[model samples]
Target chain A: MAENYQHIQTAHCENGVVTGLLKHQGLDFMTEPLAFGLGSGLFYIHIPFLKVSGGPAISFRTVPGAIFKRTCKALQIEVVRKKFSNELLAQQFLDEKIAQGIPVGCQVGVFHLSYFPKEYRFHFNAHNIIVYGKENDTYNISDPVMETVTTLTIEELKRVRFAQGVLAPKGHLYYPKSIENFDKKLIQRGIVKGIKRTVNDMLHIPAPIVGISGIRFTANKVKKLRAKLGIKQGGLFLGQIVRMQEEIGTGGGGFRFLYAAFLEEAAEYLQDDRLIPISEQITKAGDLWRSSAVQMAGIYKGRITEQKDFDDAANMLYEIAEVEKTAFKQLEKLKFNS
Target chain B: MEKKDIPQDTSPLKNMTREVYYVKNSDGKYETGLSAGWVVKNEALENAWEDINEQVRAAKQAVLTGEKSPIYYYFVLQLMDYNVLSGYTGFWKFSIKKHMTSKGFKKLSDQKIEIYAKVFNITVDELKNFNH
Candidate 1:
């Protein structure tokens, strides 16, 4: 069963899981960008009250498990998801799925994953991987973020599945129950639905700490960070932003580039050249995000401590917020042939 | 970023795996590319580790001076804070705070000590007699 399962490396975990599982079910048109777009995965949120790893709780994509759930919903696929409080029950359930040759997606903590690099091992618990088969005490793992498939011992798998702290997996697993062929019209409709949802999320969300507003809110915080926290702590805060932006799963520039790629693909699928210009706009936004990261890195590295540097970084984010706002607004205005 | 301009700086993920990046090619079309690592991300990770190490060092010194318990040292070593430790052990924040003190830790029963040990993934003996 492991040999029959094809591993597809992706830029992010949830998107990869959605794409790989669908592809395994014979959805050949499925790609990372399409999964991301259809799932409305692009997002920006900085929870002011929450602190992760001594910094702000910042996420570049939608909440964990949303990509898989939303993508499957858009494609009208029946998804079976389960969570178990008992570790033994979880293992038994997973083993049964593997014995039936069904590839199952499991949510696990990154900290206990032995194959991950030591530096990348953190307390993040939303990472996703596929378990295609088992041999003795070892389970075959297809972590989308990795270049190749790996394996985890049964104990290791159980530990990660039941890892503690915030957003614990609790031995969660999910898979599409059955897949059926659909028409091109369904794909077009899914793309439009995804784009509309994303536009609303980025532009119309009422919360100050979400969507385009959240980017602006974070920029405002960045401007005041140095004065409020002083040089040492301020630099660490900026470093946290850079880490969240350019980390492995982001596909660079806090997923702006990935969103741009999605928009480009959507344009081709919808046969709407108008989306091409919007995609270019997103690409520019991604470039600005990269530049902002470089600016933040300058302060984090302690080479540039002046207030001006902090302001410059904040200004870049402000520009990004505006650019993303425009992109989403354009998406909102575009009339799709429904 | 442009295909030719995507950064490939050496980073902690050097020998582990190459990460995917979305970049523009010569024809200005979006495509997926692979990068070993980037300097900016590496710096952020290194900075985070530095902060964690600093906290661990402080916890060790506090434990050695009898200001904190072995549990406090293990908590910091495991990259956990009071909030996370409380969540893991199902202990109240104030209880965990109290347990971090040398006096409070000494008053803990074997059963309570075992809970902390399990959360830290260590033996009860290790939790009881952790040396820095």
Candidate 2:
């Protein structure tokens, strides 16, 4: 069976407290009272109408009085729930919105999470598919009313990348090479937190190998989804995204495994041995990586499952990375013309 | 039971009206007057007040009484053109009412087109005609 994890937490708001489950960074789990408003038994964050929103954290509730009555805000805490799924949380959230006129748009997508090893799937039935096999994974996930799901394969999901550069087409938003170049820089600079350097970093690899570029494209596609009715770009927003990288020569503990895979995949230029054992395949995940991409694509379509599933995929990838050196030689000879 | 001329769009409480006259098609021009109504009625839409009332009441009563189906009042509001104000369900009724009319529709429609043009850096004509 695939690996998984779940976290549930109970929050106390003015309207009362409810237990919620969250996987990723956001507060996606359902609240108590199952209602939407602070007054509706459910504790909901009080927000304004079209008020300018800041980045990852929007600061509000600073306002006092009636405006703060049932005011609510979502905070990320470990999930403590024993039961949470689409049939429960999904429908509950939908009903709450319709009844109270929350109208935060309809369910756009679903993202399933797994723990321990870490993996993700974007479609709703992804859990079922993995457990039951793809035999009966028949459902039009693209329906306007239902959300699409996405998946992740590793411990840490590479944020999606975009194409943008000098060679980028007129209408094309991002340049592929430029984006790849950026990922290489991240590896080259290399002093990263909570991550180790890999072969990709030593050789200075690109994105398609490591998976960030695919993510950017996936996010873009999610934007095109009609059901989500994606939010409008508030205004000309610009900020720096800071990423720490380790020094190239001192490829110590910090050099990331993802980078290593990139370097090995790029070794096609020479007669030297590339792909190592499936075990040492951590630097860059291969077919497993592709399947994760498919999973992520499914995520863009809006399906997500439990944390253990995400972890299983990640652990599998890590295992693929730890494989033997002789296997690498065999893989190197297997030229993929793609 | 057919309701009288769609009840002049007497929708319930709301904060922001998604129906704030934005165009859904790639064309970038809001469909105003009767065209907008037709789009909402058949293609896709949240049930309007009259719709909500009848559907909600009947469904609730039937659920309570264990009936097969509620008294489905299939009303015809196509001739009423009251759906132009359908967006008022989630917005401030007083303010949205002032803007959901003839002149208000044109002004908001133009502004909506202009907004997209600004973001995508295309022409107004391109935005409007593009959705087609």
Candidate 3:
């Protein structure tokens, strides 16, 4: 879908030909004229094959911190990489395709670069990156003008001597000011369509079936794919399940403490009703998990004389898988109801 | 001056913040030296000097009681990211910086580092741990 949009968008922007043949392309947008107050920009758009299936394996810099910074950093890396310090934000992404600076399959979005006489401005590949840096008398990419990988620091080097990387608490995400004017366009080009191929091709991504995104898309769309596989997407809440477990007896024993937490979050986007909120789910999953674990213990102990421990564990996991399917189906079905 | 001052770094820097690395010399005492680089300010930084002050104080306390800071010994700790730049809520943490017998040498493991980031609620890049 994203690639199709880009194809037409590129032809329209580049060749100035709004060909009807560009049907699958994504340029058919009609918007109430945006209030272009500070807007001064140009860009061309195109689709690259970086798009991944299994939802293109999107990674969220999940380390935690400001969501904006993580997003900006991604933009920054690409912008500086393209060397388009002169392009307009509107067209920076389009220009990047030509710059051939960044490896192919990487597209610029909303990110552009500004060129100045003394210093090349912008730290990130993106222009108008939210964080600003101070450079010389003029505003440019922030730095001593020389950026060092964190490992080059004395502290970092010291760790390297031991063959281990320094582990520092990631506090925040920020980029130099120079890249600010280097606005990003199509920064989304590959993100929506480019990054998948790049990661898969360059990194030899292990699970091509799933890409880098740990979450699966069938589950993202159909919602009950996990249940269809006869398993829960995440887990079952034990706290809530404890109440029900006593009611369901051995049936509720399959819950795990971690279920509710992942489910609660999963529900926010998936919007399933039977989904337990994260907090209650933890305790609830724990309660249910523990009971099931107890019952499984009896079964295992009884079977231990005849079966290997690994086999028993596998059997237990399978049992848990069954419970997950029931809960996911219930939650999903309830989602439609609500 | 000792390393990494390369002429090939043509990328101009702006808003460079002067930093001092407090290093221990042959005399077994610490001295501050200069290192300048860009200081990127996040309008939405989550951890403030206030939140980490206790840990700093704890480190200082260790220094006072002949127990060096965990940072002094390990330079690593678990972190929780509240995600709110101005103010954080629902954050949690634990200590992970490792202790080495040698002076001025701190090491962190990749796996443990990943966990430290998860605990800190930060990305690996933002951990002041990435090169670019």
Candidate 4:
């Protein structure tokens, strides 16, 4: 019982799933940037005390499922979500949904997904994918991050769905029950609110390890780590930051670029000239952030050894924090007449 | 931070297939294209692999020394920590940690062994023998 599901690869997983599932429900095609923006996905946090997969926690975007949940709310879509305590029951329920011609969104652990490259596979548990159909014992998977539709055995799928870890999926499945049609007015309001929210959080958040302050805090932590951990171990820690930036989802400076892309799209949609320069500003900030990663990587690879070199990398990030601060403040002034 | 400083060595990620990355292009436009394998990315992943391998190696050594059980070795090799293993087997974290020791593993009830086997995707006999 396989439906004709179109597979669209995206830079990030959750937005891609939102775009794909919305399209599958006969809704208008949603661009990745639109989904990301409407979902209010731009965020930053660097919690040094918290550890994830053995490294200090550094997150570029909002938590997983935030975009989907926010975007669905903004779009006025009603969705049905379920989580199964039993693996067999989960599998059976998924089969029934497919038989009923509904494409289901699921959260799974990336570690057990057989199609992922071994180097990319970790114990990360919040990865999203869609199961649109089943043939024999194989489930057709539309993994948003992958280039095309793939197949996984039921046993393999179950293992990934029920993988135990931080943020375990527990066989979670979701599908939209009804999609209400909306026009450009709703999109404009969503964009305005999204930009305002980003500005407020980044500029006004009291937590030192969140928003623009978090970037600066991370820089200070990195400089201190260079002194305490020494070169070899410190380099690994620096590399973990780079990994958090580049390897995870569309991270590294990629989230900044995505946000910038959203601004570009929002500018065209609203015909607002103010957003164009802000988009350009954010793009430059993203570039500086990437430069910081590159410099950190230089230290990580032993190409740069001096403490000054590490300081310079941290300084670049500090500069980006300032750049983002200015750009987002301008975004806060955006007004929608709708 | 310049491009010239990026190390060109790709040996660390030789086992991995090259994948596409959707990144911003030079003109500040988004482009979905294959990444020119950067040494830093490979180094980061290599660091993670090293951590996992280090734990697995230590677990194997402990098992051989009769200090810990073979279940301890497989638990790590399967990429599970004690907390995750506890969640899967419905045991407390302290109890799971205790079961990692040889003496405690030997004292496990048959039902507990079966539960561990199911969670580990192994048969009960395999869980019992746990031949590396």
For B28-128, candidate 1 gives per-residue lDDT tens digits of 99888899888888898999999999999999899989999998898888877665688678999899989999999999999999999988888999888
Rank the candidate models, highest DockQ first. 1, 4, 3, 2
Among incorrect, acceptable, medium and high, the docking class of model 2 is incorrect
lDDT of 1 by residue, A136-215 (tens): 98999999988998999999999999887778899999999767666667778889999988888898889999999999
Candidate structures ordered by TM-score, highest first: 1, 4, 3, 2
Candidate 4 segments exceeding 4 Å error: B1-31, B122-132
Model 4 lDDT per residue over A232-281, tens place: 77777777787877764463364887788788888888888788899888
Which has the higher DockQ value, candidate number 1 or candidate number 3?
Answer: 1
Estimated TM-score for each candidate: 0.97, 0.19, 0.20, 0.91
RMSD of each: 1.4, 27.7, 23.7, 3.1
Candidate 3 C-alpha lDDT tens digits along A231-315: 2211111111222222110111221221232233334434443444322433343343443444323322233222233234334
| Index of the highest-TM-score prediction | 1
- Which CAPRI quality tier does the interface of model 1 achieve? medium
Which candidate number maximizes lDDT?
1
The B-chain TM-score of model 1 reads 0.91
Residue B76 Cα positional deviation in candidate 1, in Å, after optimal superposition: 1.4
Better of 2 and 4 by lDDT: 4
DockQ for every model, please: 0.72, 0.02, 0.02, 0.38
Estimate, for each residue in B1-132, the C-alpha lDDT of model 2 and write its tens digit.
011111123221111111111111233211111111111121111212223345445544543453421111111111111221222122244544444333343455576546434433358675343221
A111 Cα displacement, candidate 1 (Å)? 1.0
